[model samples]
Target: MTIPTDATPSGLGGSEPAVLSFQDLEVQFATDLGEVRAVNGISMEVHPGEVLAVVGESGSGKSVTSMTALGLLPKNARIGGVVRVTEKDVRQLDARRLRQMRGKDVAMVFQEPQTALNPVLTIGDQLVEALQLHGVAYGNAAKRRAADLLAAVGIPEPARRLKQYPHELSGGQRQRVVIAMALSCDPKVIIADEPTTALDVTVQADILDLLRSLKEKLNTGILLITHNMGVVADMADRVAVMYQGDVVEVGSAEQVLVYPQHEYTRRLLDAVPRLGAGRAQLGIAAEAPPIITDEVPALEVKNAVVEYHRLGKPSFRAAEDVSFTVHQGEIVGLVGESGSGKSTMAKCALGILPPTSGTVAVYGEDFNRLKRKDRKALQKRIGVVFQDPAASLNPRVPVGDIIAEPMVIHKVGTKTERQRRVYELLEAVELPRAAFNRFPHELSGGQRQRVSIARALSLDPELLVADEPTSALDVSVQASVLKMFMTLQAEFRFACLFVSHDLAVIDMLAHHVVVMENGRVVEQGLREQVLHEPREEYTKRLLAAAPVPNPEEQRRRREQRHAMLAAFGDKVVEIGDVPHGPEGP
Candidate 1:
């Protein structure tokens, strides 16, 4: 049975007819496992000039429901009920009509811009093709309109950017191009699926601002599907909370987020790591800080610089004059935007990428001066957990082998002993011993990450390097993983260098924080000093840009971010209107 909700449109869309509506929608897919119901009977609507955010954890039908709007569901999908875009029955639309309505009446901005766009095609070519295919413009006229769209989305050098391929543009730039493509025909409604999930907080803030600006200026309704509550707070006028393929709650952002009536919604919000909520927020009691003993630190970098050499052009300096120390049993968070040298520094610290200058010391031994055999011996004392477990863990390998491979390489124990250790590790990460025989593909994302963590701890290493390990997970899953990681860290007493862009997660897990910008450490100190009382303007701006889960608080933070931008001589993204020029007809 569907739960009762306010259901009525509010805010900018009040009393206006809905641009998109779902009436008792149901979706099911036929799989090898059997017929699985992905979406239950969900009824919702998005009104012109209003933002309706559909938020839930993975597999909760948020994406499935949105996909129905564009008729993008798979052939195996058995869809029921009505999905109306501008009151046109989507289920009844013919192929040609569906294509005609796709970019003209409604469009979609996918989650990953890289996959949404064709890599081989230039940005200009793709945009022009979209315009031409939609019968919006043609030839030189389409090219000019493409440039205008890029500019409208705030990408500088729009004309120059048009000639570059997707790989040439930064992540944020590529997203802007995708948005430009979505707006080529001035669609009445745009469906954005996890639009800012992969972006850094500052870039995420910018993208949200851009979307909000475009929605108000063009009066285009938006259907936003994401698991990010902070994003909902920032963008949504109305909120729809989905759980187990059903809409459990629906109302204004304030009603749903601030005063959630559903138990699931409350749990979801509670899982979100607020910027200032330290370990105590997750029920992890704060322990005394690690003792500063005379023993060598677990890892130390001294004026390190890492550079990537080009064929003939100047070398790209990824990190410069970077220095920090991770003490034994301590977790040091390295925070920065993408390409801000966080990962590069991690690689150098791991000895995967040798620094161009300066020294990296591991347990008081200089990694650069170590002999090959000694280096391998030293490496055996360290472990690593990458960001994407699916890519990092071999698919064909069973969970048992993946965890035991590290011990095997180092010849740590006999076969029986290794299997025993693997079992112990499975229990440590809160995974069943039965998971030992299962492949990585068989596990859920959280389980796969748990496997990764289990493998990292198998070697009993003194230090660990974890790079954005929880970035891809849902809030609830992330909270659980963080709690388990804290428990394991306490048990193992290993020092960790945790790299991530999420300030909230950093605040929750890190004992000390290091802020980086343009490959330099701008600030480094205890978590309280760096987060609560940041001294640098950049740090303040970063904190201000991070969205809180509360709509009221997010609004105030938005204003504070705008003021910070202005104070730093950086103007907020102001996309008032598309300019008419000779480049267009």
Candidate 2:
């Protein structure tokens, strides 16, 4: 089923030619070991007023191909074949001519807005600079145009936002600012590289809507690079699937996504977590036999309230009166959007933050009331998995040492015994023995996450707090990690508090669900009850906003969501005027 859009081919007039094209493109990077071919001979084109999605996992040459079109490749890289923008060959152009074509003829929207935007400059300064760089506008004219761009992207109070820096905005707002900057020069083509990968579902839906509207209004061609099949289903008119430097499949969005002919494409589709699929269908084991327990729960948080004090203003309540329980062998999912206090709740559970008003108990013992030495001893019974393994793992340490560090800290074993345990943990996580000597930088994202998992389990903790552990991974990798997590939980009978914004993932693995909104739990019950028969309007909104890989279903869901919002007189959620500091909510 295809999600129909109102977009029509009218960008720069219907008489215009293709905005971007690639023919027999080949790219290679010269390295000390050998010459590595990144992109094999491949061909594709993007016309004005259409979105052409390039979908693949990491190392599939998706980004490299798009980078070549922008002339952003390194000097040492060898490029072959033709890359054209509006009939002009980008390869034949010199540095100055290429610079002129970059913002005027083509522009790019990056995956991470924080890195793409300058931290020191105001949004107005950056947007105006982009316009002036292409000789589109300057001075008062540039400011006015910048404000217009911001308003066009659906950001409220465009004029006031110009004075704010990138850090002052939320993740969704930052991304909108990036899109506004891309439109400053009215380029014919926009290359969006994983634009919504790090965003929440509602925010992603809003961004996709804005892009579709822009395509219809301006007729700008879009080259969308992403690995998410749902995104392709929602946005693309045509699809190109890449695998290990080759174009494995190409067709219309409906044809490619629903009736994919290639084996690789089918595997990608199979790896996606469907909302209603049971554990067996998703490659996870059924719930383990209920753990025999006395009266004590594995973990408990009662009337928890966390606050952040301010120097000159009222304190902020991050988590208010939140309460939940994770029984032994149970996985309770905490679901919410960004700034919804999910992380704050996780921190409170981990005892990293002391709640101001309530108690956190582990196996019936109050965590905050324990003595210093007793608290240290209790910590050995708890494990944690952060969102980004690269940030959590020490870069300089070997995988073996990293895994063994927890044991070493708790004085669990000798050097030789710890070394043997490292190899055992590696095998348990399905990693090779050689990985024991590799550094974090030497491994893939999935491998690093596995290593983090192994390290977390090294202490053999009774409870685990996994916060968005699979959010950054590709679909296939995420599936494998989740399956492994389920298997390990079954084997060890350890309780878990899994926090994420992905309802599909939660539906696949969780026994109970807790829905959060603005630092409070709006709903909590068994998964079957909360997900299937949601009682709160906010939970229904979240379920409605989630995009399915089926285009027709997603379109239907979008329409229903819009109608629901209208009925309630509720506006689309936007980044509010919260104070932007180093600390997060």
- Work out how many backbone clashes candidate 1 has: 0
Residue-wise C-alpha lDDT for candidate 2, range 208-318, written one tens digit per residue: 888877777677899998877778888888888899888888877888888999999999899999887756557565654475456588888889999989899999998
**Residue ranges of candidate 2 with Cα displaced over 4 Å:** 1-16, 291-295, 365-367, 389-458, 571-585
Best by TM-score: 1
TM-score of 2: 0.88
lDDT of 1 by residue, 1-585 (tens): 332334554457657777898999999999776999989888888888989898887778887898899998889999999999997999999999999899888999987787789989999999999888877778889888888899988999999999999988877889988898888887889999989877888989999999999888888899998778899999998888889899888888999999999999999999999888787887888673454556789999999998899898999999999999999989999998877899888888788999999988889888778999999999999999886676789999999999999999999999999999999988876678888999987675657878888888888888999988876677887788788788778877889999987899999999999999999999999999999999998898889889988999999999989987888899788554563323335
State, as a TM-score between 0 and 1, how close model 1 is to the true structure: 0.90
Which candidate achieves the best lDDT against the true structure?
1
